[model samples]
Target: MNESIKKVAVIGTGVIGNGWIARFLSQGYEVTAFDPAAGAEERTRLAVNHAWPSLEERGLAANASKDRLFFKDDLAEAVSGADYIQENVPEREELKKSVLHTIDQHARMDALIGSSTSGIKPSILQSDMIHPERFFVAHPFNPVYLLPLVEVVGGEQTNKKALEQAGRFFSSIDMKPLTIHKEIDGHVADRLMEALWREALHLVNDGIATTEEVDKAIIYGAGLRWAQMGPFLTFHLAGGEQGMRHMLEQFGPALKLPWTKLKAPELTEELKERVISGCEEYAGDQSVSDLEAKRNEFLVKLLALVEEYWPEESQAKANI
Candidate 1:
């Protein structure tokens, strides 16, 4: 834990917000959270309970406890004394700005504010704030408690020291903070994901593959390699002795082929129902909670395996 950031506040209780709360509690941070929705506190507690087993498997800080979470009805009161605040409101531009303005007004001036937005740029999100310099995008993956990657991006007005502190704080909590020097829509991971998603939708819409088939393609093949070395190094290995240089020389022309439709297909009613029914059929008897539990267990084991093979030096080189 960053000693300068003892108290933390989470300013929403949606899926992402609850995930953040679970992670903070597991890391032994006292978290005060606010959300206006009725029964928000109950749902958050339930989410924490659901995620606890995974956190325990990952390992817990000495002081970690679910009881450290406090629910406050008033947003101002929730943020007033916090040294770090995370905003995870729904992805409406106007609403996020309004809520951020309120947090900026109430939080301590030195408090570092991070938004868990999936796509919005940090500069636009921090534009209306008085202390915009302290604000940045801290976009995290779903299942935030178990997933270690957090994309840390500073806004145009954001201070270098603020980004540095946020990186250090996230690192202390057992997270891999990837600081993005340039901001773009969907940051880094999500953009790559969105491209693949668009292509997957196109395949489904064109009747080329079923949802289950698409999933199987990734699950049995690229997903396994991606889990460790990611796309570049995986492709590099394809070059045999020559590595990436020879691989690119042989396959680079394939990039110009019409192998992908970058634009996403429209979500017509037929497509929507096909997708919903396909997923439901695939899910069969298992509830979402059941699947989540299984996924968490798998990830805990996979993460352990990943750390063994994907050492820090290799990861740094891959990033470069």
Candidate 2:
């Protein structure tokens, strides 16, 4: 709903692409999407329908409607009139570059281009574009309609004004835009997540903990506190009256301890089976769809609580 970006185009229809579509539609943007897959439109519509209830819980824009979504089989036609284009194609480098070339050829000259790539640096992704200044990475978490954080990273050629506009546009759609001026592989959030993921795999691979136990450790302990204040702030409180200073003084030595394996374990056949079977056993009778619905419900309520208790302007400024 940003004044300058009314018509939006999503250039893929996979899970992430559909998630963007649902979020854009809920924000009342007229979304035109393109995907070459068979029944891509049908699948996207179903995905939107599945996410609609959670969006309703979060509250939709006054003019929001599923009817506002449209699909075009031709990529050029889909993006021709859009003010903003979000590409969610697969992470394959050459495929992304080729798709971006087509988008660059057809999209309006001034249209802002954002890639939903989780890890690829924006610089490399934009290198082949004629209007690279308008291109950047706008990575969002899974369940894009519910998660507010979007890492907006600019490439070397990206114009500051364009990046600012992208940030403002995302903010208008109820997103927390973390503008990362420097480009790096995986940006910020994903790197932090990857670190933890590496250690988790190590634990499972080493026969130290079952996947279920790992989930419980986070769910019942750190995850709860992390939902409110992240690691730094949580540890700041852990320092008691002296804050982070005391906490660091007391625990800094642990940083050198070999308690964690930062490198991820190899995904051997046995490891894969263990992970797959463990998850299946934990899931029991619940299908993936059922779990997704439950997760959406929990996220809706958690988002509300987070908004109520989390710090606002001051906290954000302090982080900088």
Candidate 3:
């Protein structure tokens, strides 16, 4: 694929949309953004500016041209002649359906349309679209320019060509694109993350650990391994010379132990209060921006390390 990715359109200039803009702009794509909310353009510009320095620090934005970003009040104007269209609207089903419908009506037939939806499946969201085949999920984690994992999920009506095109497009921008085999609620990463979040909430509710301690348990333990490799790969390493088979044989019995609760905990008020309080206490001095900057910094370094360790294979897959 060519390194050039000119004329990308971003809908909904919120946090995720802003990140998408940054990623595209850093990759030398001329970004045209549309957002109905007032002051959305200013917010997007601020996000792009803030992200620029971080991208520069990581050497990803070197030799990349700037001033290719454009903002528009009209969605159709943004989508016209766009090479790729990324929709990052609110998570409401009706809102997404409406925006996609409009995009389907206005966007060029060949332009790829992707959603940053976290939980909503593309089938339901793109049900009202005239060209659902051109639509698919390109879900990215928060602060999209830094993180490299973009879950690419296709709906029932989503075409194979579109998925392939999207996969290629993300790769051009140095993103890791994981094509989900089937549509599942919350997709892959979010489903696994939600499970962990539920358990964390349960532990807090049970007074087992504070939010900070729980966070430390992850950052100090498996999270370090996960930064370089996933759970299965880590287990494969844990197996020593024998591999996963040996590891499983040795620890399979632990699965029977009461180690984790797979069931989700009910969001009762008392439990919610405990979780909220714990988080607030943990987040005391740092503002959201401060924490996000720290996270972006860490993610940039971590992904760069992964790229260095397993350059060929990992670089071909990971996208944010």
Candidate 4:
């Protein structure tokens, strides 16, 4: 990892773009953002300010001597000397291709570019880039400053060095980088999450439970276990001394039972209303900002617990 990679450019100023800026700036990177949209500079500044306290609370902003940040109106100026570039524009293929094409013509050749794409494959995202090897997907969850996971995916044309450099860069910022071996739709975490989401929707549609109850099923039960250990590891523990293989052998037959419908339910108007109403009811007296703050607090504490207990295979990189 290069300690000298102090400059980064963030392209786009939407919600995700603000998140990328927060994560980068909190890690002491001098972030320069480019977003031609009206009020983008103000929005980015507000997001960064809001994130600063959280970063300080986590001991991530120990080095405050560095310049706070910079916002650029010129795209060329933003990418001119950046060590890395993070693209968080809308998920329009043509728009992405156009932006990357322009960036390819302007950015430093050796600078790494990452896309905050949730579902798009890197191959498709970088098809038109002049230097595709320097570009790849570095998808991070919402509120990137809180969630540490960054899924790094390389396309067929992606440079190995770029991927390795991305891993190092994300680690330097205290992020858990998971490199996908192949280009797959939705990558890893989202795919697993979508599967469960489909079932959750199905249950709601079938009137098996209200949305709040379904949320309870997660927050009050298996979700707690999942936060500490993955499903396989949790099941291994469930099997006691027998471990996963033994548990699988014993439970394999029951797996065929019609427990869950993998099919997703249609987002009908009534279902949508039900979900909205359920959330509104759950919210009670809390405003959206208050609820969000509470949620973020829980996530930070939960993740800290995970790090303390079930450390990842790449735990050594956390100290970088």
How many steric clashes does model 1 contain?
0
lDDT of 2 by residue, 211-315 (tens): 999999898989999999999999999999999999999999999999898578899999999988989999999999999999999999999998888876346
Taking all chains together, the TM-score of candidate 2 against the true structure is: 0.97
Cα error, residue 91 of model 4, in Å, equals: 1.7
Give the lDDT of residue 275 in candidate 2: 87
Tens digits of lDDT, candidate 3, 15-107:
899998888878777888899887887777788888988887766544464477888878889998686889999999999999999998998
Q: What is the C-alpha lDDT of each candidate?
A: 0.93, 0.92, 0.85, 0.84
Model 1, span 1-320: residue lDDT tens: 13398889999999999999999999999999999999999999999999999999999999999999999989999999899999999999999999999999999888999999989999999999998999999999999998999999999999999999998899998899999999999999999999999999999999999999999999999998999988998899999999999999999999999999968999999999999999999999999999999999999999999988885656556441
Worst 10 residues of 4 by lDDT: 59-68
**Shift in Å, residue 228, candidate 2:** 0.7
lDDT of 4 by residue, 106-135 (tens): 888788889998999999988998889889
Clashes of each: 0, 0, 8, 0
TM-score of 3: 0.91
In angstroms, what RMSD does candidate 3 have relative to the true structure? 2.8
| Top-lDDT candidate index | 1
Residue 169, model 1, lDDT = 94
